[model samples]
Target: MNVTLLMAITINGFVAGQDDDTEWVKDIDALYKMTAEAGVAIMGKRTYDECVKYNAFPYKGALNIVMTHDKTLLTKSTDDVIFTDATPQGALQLLEQKGFDHALVIGGGNINGSFLKAGLINEIILDIHPMVMAKGIHLFEGDFPYQQLELMSFTKINDDLLQVKYRVKNNYENS
Candidate 1:
């Protein structure tokens, strides 16, 4: 299974503000396109909560799973949405068992860090915007070991945005 980390972050590497505000992000269509292509997206509870707060819940055309311990927040989950308390590796294993060819970690710091720490992310696709927020949640929250990546491709998404794709180098394989 291919595990890709797909995210849009500020120039300073912040995904969102302290209040879970994403007013700075401008490309909803791009995100929807990625969601459509990935078919499966895993996000932290904060990401889900922010989407719901902004009336963007139930991302269509994909199975969205919210990785959270407090599953009680959701009274129930439908086919399009589900809650799980699985670790990063466990979540990927479950998805693979279900026959998903690709899984995208659409994040809010903690989830991204967990996957990177667990060495579950194979690639990273970042759409870097022009703005920067000094005080906000970072791209990855915890301290993870240094990761090596080889750039696969890069393109200008628009006049103000650039998208970069990289293949995460497996140290064990390379060594």
Candidate 2:
């Protein structure tokens, strides 16, 4: 299965403010479009909550999986959402069984790190916003072994936004 870790981060690499404020994020339409095209998307509980703040729920026509240990975090059921405590590996397995050849890993930070640490991510597309925060959540939360990437493509979304795509290199155990 193909998995892409897609996110937006500050120039200094912060995904959110120290207070967990995501207002600095811009160019959400592109993100939404990418999510829509993926057919399957997964994110951590916190990332899901942040997305709800902007009412980007349901992710129409896509299977939106919320990875969380606490079931109660999900207030109620939704048509296109599946709340699961599955590990990244287990979640990918489920997606594979469902015949989804590709999935997108949407995140705040920790979830991205988990997939990277597990060697499950194949590509990363970052929408880099031009800003820097001295203290804030990073693009990848926990400590992970260094992984290399090969730049695939990049484009300027606007005067302030630059989107870059990278293929994960030397990230798999068998590589």
Candidate 3:
């Protein structure tokens, strides 16, 4: 399986505010398109909560996998959705067993941290918006060792939005 990390962060590398506010993320159409193309989305519980808070859960056209220790969420698992307590490697293994070819790790810091820390993400695409949140959620929130990224490419998504793609150096291989 090809695992990719897709997220939007401020120029200062914050993904959300203290209140879990994402009013700064404005490229929904682009985000939706890229995510849908992946066929599967893996996210943390908080990211799932935020999506539901805005009435946008069970992302259409893709299987949604949420990682959480909440056993109640297991009941929600179906052919199209999965709520698992799997670790980053475990989650990828599950997806591979299910025959998914590509998957996207849609974020909330800890999830990103786990995947990156496990060296499971082959690529990362960050939609860097032209804004700054002094104090909020950092891109990788959990404890992880240093990672090196090799620039793949970058493009101007809009007037002020820059989309940058990077490969996790030393770990980017055909998955």
Candidate 4:
């Protein structure tokens, strides 16, 4: 399956403010369009909560999977939205079983790191915003294994936004 880790972060690499404020990450129609085209999307609980708090829950036109240990979310599961405690791989497996060949790993931070650290991510497309925060949530929450990425493309989404795409190198490809 093809998995893409797609996110928007500050130039300094913060995805949200220290207090989890993501007001700066708003209204990027490009991001919404990309994830929607993927047919399926998975995100961590915190990310899901933020999306909800911002009135952006249940990404339209895609199967939205929320990964968390909070089983109560199961009650909210439906044909289009699934709340589960599945691992990143497990979530993607579910997507594959549903006949999806590709998915987008939407994120806040920790989820992005988990998928990358597990070597499950195939591509990363970052929407680089204009500001920098001294203290905040990073692009990747935990320590990463330092796999390299091949530069695929980089261009302006607008005057203040720049989008960069990279293909994650597999273990053998790095050799």
Q: Highest TM-score: give the candidate number.
A: 3
Q: Whose lDDT is greatest here?
A: 3
What is candidate 4's lDDT per residue for 58-112, written digit by digit as tens?
A: 8998889888888688777998899988788888888888889999999868999
- Indicate the worst ten consecutive residues by lDDT in candidate 3: 166-175
lDDT, model 1, position 98: 80
Runs of candidate 3 exceeding 4 Å displacement: 171-175
What's the lDDT for candidate 2?
A: 0.87
Question: How do the residues 1-175 of candidate 1 rate in per-residue lDDT, one tens digit apiece?
Answer: 8999999999899999868778878788889888888899899998988888878887889998888888585557677787888888888887888889899999989999999888888999999999877798888889777888999999997898899999999745433
Note the Cα lDDT for every prediction shown.
0.87, 0.87, 0.89, 0.86
TM-score of 4: 0.93
**Order of candidates by TM-score, top first?**
3, 4, 1, 2
Give per-model TM-scores: 0.93, 0.92, 0.95, 0.93
RMSD of candidate 3 to the truth, in angstroms, is 3.1
lDDT of 3: 0.89
Candidate 3 structure quality by residue, lDDT tens digits, 1-175: 7889999999999999879989889888788888789889999999999999998888888999999999899777898889999888898899899888789999989999988878888999999988887788989988767777999999998898899999988643543
Screening candidate 2 with a backbone cut-off below 3 angstroms (N, C-alpha, C), the clashing residue pairs are none
Clashing pairs in model 3, backbone N/Cα/C closer than 3 A: none
lDDT of 2 at 82: 82
lDDT of 1 at 172: 50
